[model samples]
Target chain A: MGNVREAVDSGTWSLPQWADQPPDPDLTGASFLLISYGDSEAEAVVQQWEAGLRRTDLDPPVLRFHASAFDRDQLADKLAEARCGVRLMIAGGQYDVLQAMATARALGLETGEITRYATAYEDLPLFCPHCQTTSRAYAEVFDWTDCTGCHRVLTIKPHYSSQRGSFLGVDTR
Target chain B: MTDQRRLRVTEVRSLCPEIRQITLEPLEGTALMGFQPGSHLILHAGEHRNAYSLTGDGIMPSRYTVSVLKRNDDGGSAWLHQHLAPGSEITAEGPVSMFAPVHNQQHALLVAGGIGITPVLSHASALAALQKSAEVIYAYKPHRAAHVDQLREICHSAGFRLTEVTSAGNCRKALRDRMSDQPVGSHAYVCGPMSMLESFLEIGAAAGWPEYRLHLERFEAPELDPGEEFALRVSGSPEDLRVPVGVSILETLESAGYSVPNMCRQGVCGQCQISVRSAGSLEHRDYVLTEEEKAAGGSLMVCVSRGTDVEVAL
Candidate 1:
């Protein structure tokens, strides 16, 4: 242990750096949750984690859900049922992860209890610094998009804002 | 550096043979900055400086209250008990938050051991002020037990019970039973002796309590054993400098006129981290480093950690 929860909650984990080996990392909690984005890469992540749990011989309480399977209310209900040590993992495209992160934060799960790994960077929520407007991005790092509010060409910076669950967009002008 | 506040002692009352509560008001200003609950302030009186946790409400407080346990040693507590008067003026710093309740906690479990009850009191006040519920467990010797009545009053309004114990065995049993009964999203905040804190942490981990959910504030630093003498090499110091027994590597470096970036010289803070070019074997006593980092032998927290035949890159 490292104070991973403190780093994430403080927003110092602002810069986006997905865990390189998400599935293999010693993900800990009393109970485990996997909300996959329905992508092939994300499904594989859930499968490996499930297999590891089996290998450990601890039949821990686990909840599995597709990103689209439940609405925010249902997700909150499910999270509420689990105790404090529910390790919530989100594996998906950037957009789905962003959408799910909002629900986690709202559920008061404001710690490293939640782990995220976005395998495909698509449909990310971009915050346009120029106009303070948020726009959906079908792009990844170093990609360009037109801001929906100002219609200005914006470049997505690698910096992440966990407080906003959105990518920082510098006006490319 | 933090700004120091000028305060005048407004009142002082002896709670027990071992405990005294002091109340302070601003020496000049009308109000003090509000602080987070479970935070401490360093009292600066003469040449002595010691941190005492605030025992009252942290919000818009008209005065600050702290309970001091008179120690047998000639430390700050003894000095304050002997010298502090109603009109005495002193300079202090902090309201620094080493321990604070998580605002999002569904339920809060607070534990206090002996004089460590100071911060736990502050947490209870904060929880009540915020209209939240908490279960407080306090263990102390009956003769010197402090704040039983006050803890009762606060817990009454906050809709929780305060569990008080006189013996160590009963304390352990109470903690074990309560640790298993907390609701989801519950958090535990503990302030106590080094051994008690260690035991609570171990028990919490064993019970599947997440590390982030368990908060701890230590009033005393861990007692590290003095190890075999070692030789040090640093950027600003001579190579193969002999470090003697009972002397920390940081102190040794400082005596040789080398200023090392450091704080909490007790090894809790990672401020004194230095790269280890190589080492024979490092006895890692610091809380800041992980087991993997300690095993890697690439870095050292010189404040308390010691190593034999170590070469420091920094």
Candidate 2:
């Protein structure tokens, strides 16, 4: 188990790293999607990933595996059972998600293949939910600020297009 | 901002099975502004970016705490438990302002479930630090309880009221009663599992807590209903890429060698901002856009938001 961390740190995961001959990896163990914010972000990110699969024509549908939040033990058990290979573990945050990605990569599982980085967002506009005034923007768009109106923190959003690419908005309430 | 600087991890301790409580201290030679009692930190854990509440006060020695609960079915927790050893260096952003406590409220009721207790733990401590009394109701399944010793110590030392509910049989009933007893000036802070959070909100709403007084930090964002696949036409590319109902646009673009800047892919930050050149309608989920921006259909964060069966040229 500890070796999994080493693998991720060093960027390596082999097929036989955490399993005994690739036992029924998907079935005997459960797959988890431990999201930190809530269901909305989880579903939104999952949906986005599913869409990516179709665009790339990645066979077997990434969504076919499905996503569900798992706790510590549940996640570990699934990884162990997934001895057949390393499974995808998308991260909701940098520290938390990276650790998961690293561990999966370490256990001889393909690091990049098993974990993905997705954003955790509170639903709605770009305004600073705290201050409600200063229009939020990312590093390039605007010098990021917590908020001038309410002092509430603001998170960056990614726009699908190029111009007006993700900026901050106000909280209506 | 000059006020908020990255605090360094001073110490880490295992609280219970699969749970680690991290103590953070301000870096030497850096002027660290104190965090509001209920502030939280964004941990850059490996590839994932997760949020955790600060258990310590905002000011110096600038102690902050985060509790990590191991997952059973995923690789994230195992990696954290195994790799996060003493003296390991990592970066933490903010003592963010997501969990601030209301100053004007007459009575504040704090409810926490499982690891959701992190933020509320600080709230309770803050109320005590301010000499303001608040009631705390900690709910957990009877089988998985942790941090009794530490929680009890904080509760008693802080002089704040505390109630521990173990039996699943009367959990909701107990929460309802405690909430009902509070006066009009009370503000409620609720954090926990999705089901419990929903239940608490329903009961709180029934008891007349305004939507604003009740603050929430969800363990995971809510999922949206899926529909027919949409066409995500990549800019600078000729082909119209089809994004199925449940896939992400970023992955679609990335697989094509088109890079989109992103950090926390859960829609918390606006790192992966893009424009919907043309689309049916966008189901915006990222927290970076202002109301005006979303209204203008000018910009969107592709990390999470999606479209409804239209051509979105990103």
Candidate 3:
């Protein structure tokens, strides 16, 4: 409910340097956990995160999951075991990271309790407003994406849906 | 003509020493319009207009029921309690919606304090009918816990959880624990005294609840803070109307011949929202707008929001 970092716009491609910094001291009181995709891009981001965490006294726990192997049930179990006072750091491709955020929300973690740093923008999770279906797209840049549900071309909107945990795609055609 | 319809009181019973439950039916012998859970009807008794939450079943409700807590020197409740008898006719405006359950929520946590339990009761009933999981925490004075037997029965039938915390109990700690245990996508609805509502909101937020997941319904109007006199410049109007120090923006606009649609004049309803063409030092007092909307200065609820001097697109 408190202020979470704003979604980085596609136009603002340069990531903030502070986003690479260790979790803020205010968040250090809780158990620090990191979730990252197993891809090379995400691995580089995790390395930075580990280096940042090592600079501090916190020995944070790290977990990596492949996009195909990310089991929501396992994540739910881990979240249940973490209980209260857990600060989570997430890094992955846009789609992978959004899936993790959705899981975190399902496990009762507020946006304020989780920090996200997008590692790769190659893939995006797009929600078709027409048929209310969400699918992934692989594109270097977001423009018009085809919806598998409605078979319509959708233009990705600048806005994101916190409820859907995905980028909203409006029917442009 | 007002939008009010005449209804006859079919039954009246004292729920507690200070609270009375009145049941009404349409005089035309037709089913009243279906209202969503947490909807309220405004009783128009002469010049006294007061909003009361409909406590009966929202789905195909046969009779509209409301519980009024009698207050000394309060003409509305006092007059209804003393003079209104069975078969007596009354005028009521609407089942306007200010609070309702968020759709597709995984679970619902309802918190009610004192007479604020009116709307919470309806929400619980609706959640039960929908077979959605719900937990209701009702905080009240130990001696003034009204309709406990009936509420327990309803919860039992609906498979919902009910926790009654008295004034002597540690209600805050209980509420905090419940909020902490709620799963993700769980929505919380609270209606109670201002202090209790504020406390629940703070506790829920601290326990990782998002703003969209939390709902509130305040039974009383917002307290107004004194502001300096200001002028309202209506678009296409020749004269700029002066809003006195104590007058609300809605009152000033109404006096200036603008029929601004409004309900829950306390600013809870978004009906009176008006686009602000330009403004100087706008003071926003409504609960409807988000922080970004308020900062953007594009619109405001004229019922409660004001400014030193502002130009509005009527």
Query: Which candidate wins on DockQ?
Result: 1
Between candidates 1 and 3, the one scoring higher on DockQ is 1
Off by over 4 Å in 2: A1-173, B1-9, B31-33, B141-144, B157-159, B222-224, B231-242, B253-280, B284-303, B309-314
User: lDDT tens string, model 2, A1-173?
Assistant: 34434434343221112221211112111122222323455455555544544455322213223334323454455544432212354534232343344444343343323535445322222334354442323232212335546665443322211111123433322
Q: What is the C-alpha lDDT of each candidate?
A: 0.79, 0.57, 0.75
- What DockQ does candidate 3 have relative to the true complex? 0.16
- Model 2 iRMS: 22.4
- Cand 2, B chain, TM: 0.77
Model 1 per-residue lDDT tens digits across residues A1-173: 13433343554435566767764524456667777875687888887777777677556777877754225676777777776656777888776777677678766676466778778765788888889987778786557889999999987776777767788899855
Q: What TM-score should be assigned to candidate 2?
A: 0.54
- Which digits, one per residue and each the tens of the lDDT, describe model 3 over residues B1-314? 13779989999999888898999999875668888899888887555777889886589978899998887766688878887789999999788777877766677888889888899889888877778778888888877777677678777855488888886246797777888765445789998888787888788766656566779888666588867899888888889789898888889989878888776678776768899988878988988888889999999998888897798987
The two-chain DockQ for each candidate, comma-separated, is: 0.30, 0.01, 0.16
TM-scores of the candidates in the order shown: 0.72, 0.54, 0.76
For residues B151-238, could you state the per-residue lDDT of candidate 2 as single tens digits? 6776785446788887544669877787666643456887787777788878766554545556776666566555457777765667
Q: Over the stretch B1-314, how does candidate 1's per-residue lDDT look in tens digits? A: 35788899999999999688999899674578789998787788557777789998799988999999987668788888988989998788877776777877788899999988999999999889888878999998888788888998898974687899888888888888777666667899988888778878877876568777788787668678888887888755555588899998888888877778765678764568889988888888887666778999889889899978888875
Question: What is the DockQ ranking, best to worst?
Answer: 1, 3, 2
lDDT of 3: 0.75
